[model samples]
Target: MTTEHTGTPRPSDAELARIAAELRALGEPEFDAELEATPVASLVRELAVPTAFALAFGPTDSALPAGAADPAGAGGLLDVAPLTELDRARVWRKIVARRSGGAAQHHGPRAPSWRATWVAVATAAGLALVPVLSTPDRAATPAGRAAAEALGSQARAALEGVPGEQDGGRAAELAAQYSARLSSSGSEAPR
Candidate 1:
């Protein structure tokens, strides 16, 4: 089945593979099938997947060969300016900085409002009380103990009564009995 994209025609698998190999030699790897199926322009807008893959497979310094163009000239597939080692390094640094900055922003300290502090205290107290609340009632009444013992006995008896055979012998016997009953009732069971 063919995937449809607006703006440009999709490249054949062979062409994509060839371009992917060239990009790989340059340090970028081929896009996974999922990414390849995405419209080229949309892929470029996301930036991370294509940029990372290009950096992995495409040359760091020289302009990408003309053969490297995807049938759809979505900007992600081609770079007019060849990337140098320095350029690649810069890109790597920026990527790292963006990631770290995001993390730092997420983790940065903030003033705890009174409501937040109260919530935190309440959560802590609730967590601390869990063990006390969850502790089983060890001192059962004599009647309760007797009832529990009776229930346990019934469970054990039920388990013991169940057949544990894995072979179809029991099933076959049951089926035969069912068939016999059906025949006696003058009805044919479905095969």
Candidate 2:
């Protein structure tokens, strides 16, 4: 893919270098002084690692030969050229491309839809509960007994204050029936 620039032309390398020199000349005095005072060895120790990674899995090898070459090229400061306008532009373009192209292609497996995810979760729950429900004597389990007791108490509480048309013992009869069923099976009675 190509990005065609339609805005103002990018600055040339010489112009970028001149501007960088001017900015350096106008540097913050305190910060520049502090940086100058910081020893190179201390700065190297602090900035040796670009990331928070540490060697974890490999065997220990602290001792190296007297004149072993630095394979990682971390012996001293690298001789690097100043960044030009083109470098800055390229970096900006990369960042923009990453942000815009995030949704353009699927990197891995496509995610399931919300509805499909819910359906899958419900199916798994139902399957998991099948054996528990099918147990012949559910009240035999401690969890089932606890559930039955909780249900019976809730039913009695619900029937406490409702007004009835007559003095019929309907509420008492319902509560008794629910208690009996719970004592027997720890499950709701069939409709």
Per lDDT, the best of the predicted structures is 1
| TM-scores of the models, in the order given | 0.23, 0.20
lDDT of 2 by residue, 18-132 (tens): 2222222323233234323322212221122211111221211221222332343233323223344556565335334442343232232333454568899999999999988
Clashes in model 2: which pairs?
none
For residues 113-166, what per-residue lDDT tens digits would candidate 1 score against the true structure? 545788999999999999999999899999999999999999999988997653
What are the runs in model 2 whose C-alpha is more than 4 Å off? 1-109, 113-118, 138-191
Q: Where does candidate 2 have its weakest 10-residue lDDT segment?
A: 50-59
Instruction: Please provide the root mean square deviation of candidate 2 (C-alpha atoms, Å).
Output: 21.9
User: How many clashes show up per model?
Assistant: 10, 0
* Stretches of candidate 1 exceeding 4 Å from the true structure: 1-112, 137-168
Question: Roughly what TM-score does model 2 have, to 2 decimal places?
Answer: 0.20
